[model samples]
Target chain A: MKRNAAAFGAGALFAVGLALSGMTRPAKVVGFLDLAGDWDASLAFVMMGAIAVHFVAYRVVLRRPAPLFDVRFHLPTRKDIDLRLVLGAALFGVGWGLGGYCPGPGLVSAAAGSLGAIVFVVGLTAGMLIEQAVARALPRRE
Target chain B: MHDFTPIPALIGGAIIGLAASLLLLTHGKVAGISGLYGSLLRQGTSDRAFRLWFIAGLAAMGMLVRLTWPAAFASAWSASLPVTLLAGLIVGFGTQLGNGCTSGHGVCGLSRLSVRSLVATLTFMGTGFATVFVVRHLLGGAR
Candidate 1:
């Protein structure tokens, strides 16, 4: 129960941050994307600040043997560059440039009752479902 | 135009950073939206409750903020639903294929100094640049 509460609290705080940061506003995102127009550099600062905090945070967490939740830090071990990574990045970029909302903000915006957000979430879930189906149908390579 | 100063951007960024850090400290989980959502689909009854509550809290936070600061809601880019849906599908597929989203790889994964994340981030970012180039410049979808 406590863990659940903690998760919910974290999610709520994340949502508030997204709203306060103007991430919920698609125009701001589009402006940032618009290199030729009056560009908005706010997202860059947001990314920088986020990176700075994470740098320090990880240093501290790494000092500890394990995390508070009793699990090893679930960092990815794979290092190879492959088609899946490149293709995924391309698709994400195309979607973001066109819609001006990524998954995090899209989910939060949908919660805020934005019709665009709702559509985005639906499509996102459908995509996930399709991926799962394809993965299931494919023969195991290992 | 959206009026904002460097101060708010910095402050907002810091707050987001702090929140993300705290989440990591407490739950030992990166604030990755895709992983969080994916967990809900894969995990069983024991997991469903927490994920559901977490997602619900995200929605409630938006409502609370909307009630407190109505001005933030004002924006001109209420795009058509179909466009948004298509965009979402692409992002979903991309994240699944890439193994992370912006928050996951861009913020958290990069912080860990993961080379794969670095490559993924660059790819996503570069693709974003190209996409805007095609959409607004070549395609001429101004504003």
Candidate 2:
């Protein structure tokens, strides 16, 4: 119960940061992508700042042997380049270039009651559900 | 390009970094948006109560921000609804196929120095650059 509260608190903080950073706005994203036009390099700075912090913090965390909340770091161990990954990357790029909203920003923007963001989130969630169903239906290879 | 300045951008970046770091510290989970959403889809029941709440809190923050300061929320980008929806569907499919989103892999995963995430991030980013080039120069349709 307490952990849940903490998670919500952390998420709220993240959302607030997204809002303040103008990440929720599609225009900023589009501008960032637009190299010829009046591009906004602000997001780059954001990325840099985030990377710098994570660089230091991750080392500290990894040294602890295990995380505070669990037993291990819980990172993915897969290392394969397949068709699904390539196709997915292409699709994601198309969506981002066209809509200017990725999952994180889309969720944050949806709170603004924008019809576009709402539609995006709904579709995003629906797609996930559909994928799960399809994955379940597939015959087990093992 | 007109009004939003550097101060807000810097402050916002710091805040996001702090929030991400804190989440990592407390929950020991990367603040990857796609993975969180994906988890919600699979796994019927477990220790997911907090994950759902975190998603909800994100929505509420949007509402609060808009209500408190509408001007800061102004955006310049505009596109047809159909286009945006199609784009979103593609992103959804991509996230599933790739096993994560930009936030999941690009930001958090790369930060952790995961080799897979590095490859995925490179692919996505390279694709993004190529997309913009194609859309603006070769195709000359999207805007």
Candidate 3:
């Protein structure tokens, strides 16, 4: 119950931040992506601010042996930069450039009942589902 | 950039960072939206309750903002229906395959000093730049 409450609060705060930063708007997102033409660099500030805060906050919070509500910190262990990561990122970037929405903003905007957001989210879900299917169908290489 | 608004951007970013930090501190989990949402769809996964609550919070907040302050939430991007749909599909697939997006890899993973996240971020940014150039300048997709 406490963990769930924390997650909910965090999500709400995140949504508020995304909207306040103008990230929920597809045009604002694309404006930042538009390098050649008239570019809007506001979102860069958003990234910088977020990184700065998290950079310090993470180190501080991590000093504790365990999370306030959990047994241990659940963090990613992967370090290698593989083909899949690069290709997947490249593909995601193309989509981002094309659509002006990533997962976070996409979800937020979709929640607001924007037609564009809804369409993009549907495609996003379909894409994810398809990827999962493909991954399963492919032979595993351990 | 003439449209640069640093104050709001910084504040908003800080809020996002704070939220991510809170989640980490309390739940010991990275606030990766794509991962959270994807896991909910996958079978045999635990922690469905937290995911549902988190997503619900996001939606409720969004709806609240839309209703309370419409002006502050307006956007300017306008693309064709087909273009938007295709872009959506690509974004969904790419993020899933990549295992993260802006929030996951860009914010949370990068904060952890993950090399994988760094490489992923660079690649996505590069491709995004290239795609925008092609779509807007070359193909005249939209202005």
The number of the candidate with the highest DockQ is 3
Pitting candidate 1 against candidate 3, the one with the higher TM-score is: 3
lDDT digits (tens) for residues B1-143 of candidate 1: 25444555555566666666766776666777776775665525244665676677778887787778754545675556787788888888788777788788887888888888888888888888777778778877743
Runs off by more than 4 Å, candidate 3: none
Best by TM-score: 3
Error of 3 at B40 (Å): 1.0
* All candidates: DockQ: 0.66, 0.60, 0.82
Q: Per-residue lDDT of A15-126 in model 2, one digit per residue for the tens?
A: 8777777778877877777666676777676666666667677677767776656666666677776766677766676677777788877987787788788888877877
**Per-model C-alpha lDDT, please?**
0.74, 0.73, 0.86
How high a TM-score does candidate 3 get? 0.97
The Cα error of candidate 1 at residue B46, in Å, is 7.8
lDDT of 1 by residue, A1-142 (tens): 7767777887787777677777788877777776776777787777777788887887887787766664665556788878887888778888888788888788887777777778888988877666656666886464
Model 2 stretches astray by more than 4 angstroms: A139-142, B1-7, B43-45, B136-143
Question: Per-residue lDDT tens digits of candidate 3, residues A1-142?
Answer: 8888888999999999898888888788888898998899999989888899998999999999999988999899988777888888999999899888888888888888787888888888888888888888887574
**TM-score of every model versus the real structure:** 0.91, 0.89, 0.97
Error (Å) of candidate 3 at residue B18 is 0.4
Compared with the true structure, what per-residue lDDT tens digits does model 3 show for residues B1-143? 77778888899999999989998899888888888888777778787887888888898898898898875456666666677788878877788888899988999888999999999999999999999999888988663
Q: What fraction of correct interface contacts does each candidate retain?
A: 0.65, 0.60, 0.81
Name the lDDT of candidate 1.
Answer: 0.74
Deviation of model 2 at A75, angstroms: 2.1
